[model samples]
Target: MSNSSLLKTAVLAGSLLFGTAGATVGEEADARKILGSMTEYVSSLDALSFDFEEYHEIVTTDGERLGLAASGSVALVRPDKIRVLRRTGYTDTDLAFDGQTLSLTDSDAGLFARHALPGTLDHLIDTLRDDFAKPLPAADLLTGGGHGGLTAPTAEIKDLGVGVVSGMLCDHLALRGEEADWQIWVAQGDTPYPCMFIITSRNIPLAPQYRIEVHKWQAGPVEADFAPEKPAAATEVALADYLKGARNLPPNFIVEVEK
Candidate 1:
């Protein structure tokens, strides 16, 4: 069987094994409602900042699944400005999008790239994904209308009840998509921030997963600069060249868009 066909079969097996069949209609409705509330609350924020830990699993040629881990912080202002800093054992990278330009810097490699893309945060996210093939992890939660974006491809929703993340009580939900399955934990109460997100790829052997856990979340006025500062010794390069160089970097530094 082809990989895609095998993936379909594996998805079916996963649905059965994960109890997706047992989710009741009411439970599904509740799960969707919770997700909507969380998205709405996040959209209403004028500015937000958070610290996160991320894990991405890769399946080797021999079918051994190994994980790569990174820690990062995100700071955003509504509509236009955002900054993300990520650090792994081998790389320290920074991405900043102001109103008129987007910049990416590899601090460890002494290289940087810049592109003029004038738009909102949502547009920047789309450009990064569609044009550059760099999709930020848990990006659905960062868009202006995240509810619609996330729910558009959802085939099923399951309320898995409550969980505690970073000492905060949260509502756990599972959602099945056309090609993959994902889960989220949203903090309970009015804030309703996302505490954790996990996506598993059925198309890959051993079902590699990507996970993000939010350690700190803050929403309000952020007093900081959004301008991208090029490192003094860093050489500027075309965006494509930057991406090419990324492939030579440590594991998980290269972008891998889902098929």
Candidate 2:
């Protein structure tokens, strides 16, 4: 084989496999063991609810990119419910999930937008594939795989070692995706939390880079009221009246079918 061919083969071999037969050998063996243990720690979770503060910034070229620094309080009620309230300097946007529908209300703009919610966890994971430009393959949590109600990631993964993230120790998830290579840091040591996840672009335009940072998390029911707190200035109309006005809009005005 040529030098280039040989080099490519070596890298592929490494991504697919990790440890080799040995009586009492290297660091690779231990990392594999921890990845499995951590996977189980994460997969066995039944339902989880957490509150977080996310700072999102997106800068696009043709008015497609959203760039702003914001701080907010968010609440997620397992299976499918999420509420996000953010203050972007002078404006506030509330993103709420009500089982099957998501409401995006711009408090300052005086506009309300809604979208269809993804039904399943696996589907939500798939939805992110296009947005991040990096594929999340099928697998189980313990084996570098995706975990949900009925699906999982089927990627080959090797735990390198225990790495510190956000002041906690976590198992490093290093593997290959369907469209490109990937890396995610899973909680390992004391915290039992997902430290961070990053997906780099594969074959897409607009220099896409997606990173998710999970801060303080509380995995259980909490005292949170998700009732829509509409601004007092918003035109008051009965639900029946609002529904009447909605009928005048285009069919399926909430979530649009991509052309």
Candidate 3:
């Protein structure tokens, strides 16, 4: 696939999560409890790992199905480190995150690109569970109006009924933002971690979905790798020259492009 397609995948995968409506008096009480517990569960997460197998299919507005594609063993360690390494029908690609940088290296295309992480490790955990597409609602749920970042739905007021998600029972809720709408389901009990999330755009013809599962967790003071030997100099002559002449990079940050 082209790099733009991959970038769309990445940008789409990590959207914001939030409640657009303010809750009512009695209902707000219950919603607050559920939302609070859910927050605690996520806030308490640290040093965990997840391994997931993903299936991706992109059908453009024109009704072209790129066809069903799948991958195995998508792994991650908290604090912005991820590795999508597996054999599959799709492109052979390597995506990694050290604590500070995100890199995508397409071996088949001999291309690589990197960008800086805007915040601390906790932010990454919030991003991971959002979805394969990272729907914006997921991001808002975490940022919550601090430091001029995105805000999440208070979902505390919606009279969302119960539903079965991926064989697990959960409370279903609906929320809308200025730019999007969300349908999310979470575990019914205390600390309701998101079982599934879906997002739809109001102004654009884009509807993307993300399903997240906590496949596994590993404990430690370990970090993910960011540097895997710079791209081959000969292969990246133009890119290297471009970087050498680049400007305006944030302090303590790195920029990488692979092609």
Candidates by TM-score, descending order: 1, 2, 3
Instruction: Residues 1-259, candidate 1: write the lDDT tens digits.
Output: 9999999999998888884346888888898899889878988899998899999888766667878889999888988999898887788888888899988888777889988889998888878888877886558767623522456658788899999988999999888877788888999988998898888898778999988898878998776567777789899999888887753336544445668
Off by over 4 Å in 2: 1-73, 86-91, 113-156, 205-207, 234-259
Best by TM-score: 1
* Model 2 agreement with the true structure over 1-259: per-residue lDDT tens digits: 9999999999999978966323333444664455555555555554444333333334344435433344555555555555666665556666565566545555555556554655744454455354533232221321224542111342344565567767877777555455544556767655465555555455545435445455665555655544465666654444333333432122322433558
Q: Report, for every candidate in turn, its global Cα lDDT versus the true structure.
A: 0.82, 0.50, 0.48
lDDT of 3: 0.48
In the order shown, the candidates' Cα RMSDs to the true structure are 7.1, 10.5, 12.7
Query: Candidate 2: lDDT of 158?
Result: 53
Question: Candidate 2, residue 83: CA error in Å?
Answer: 1.6
Assess the local accuracy of residue 19 in candidate 2 as a C-alpha lDDT between 0 and 100. 63
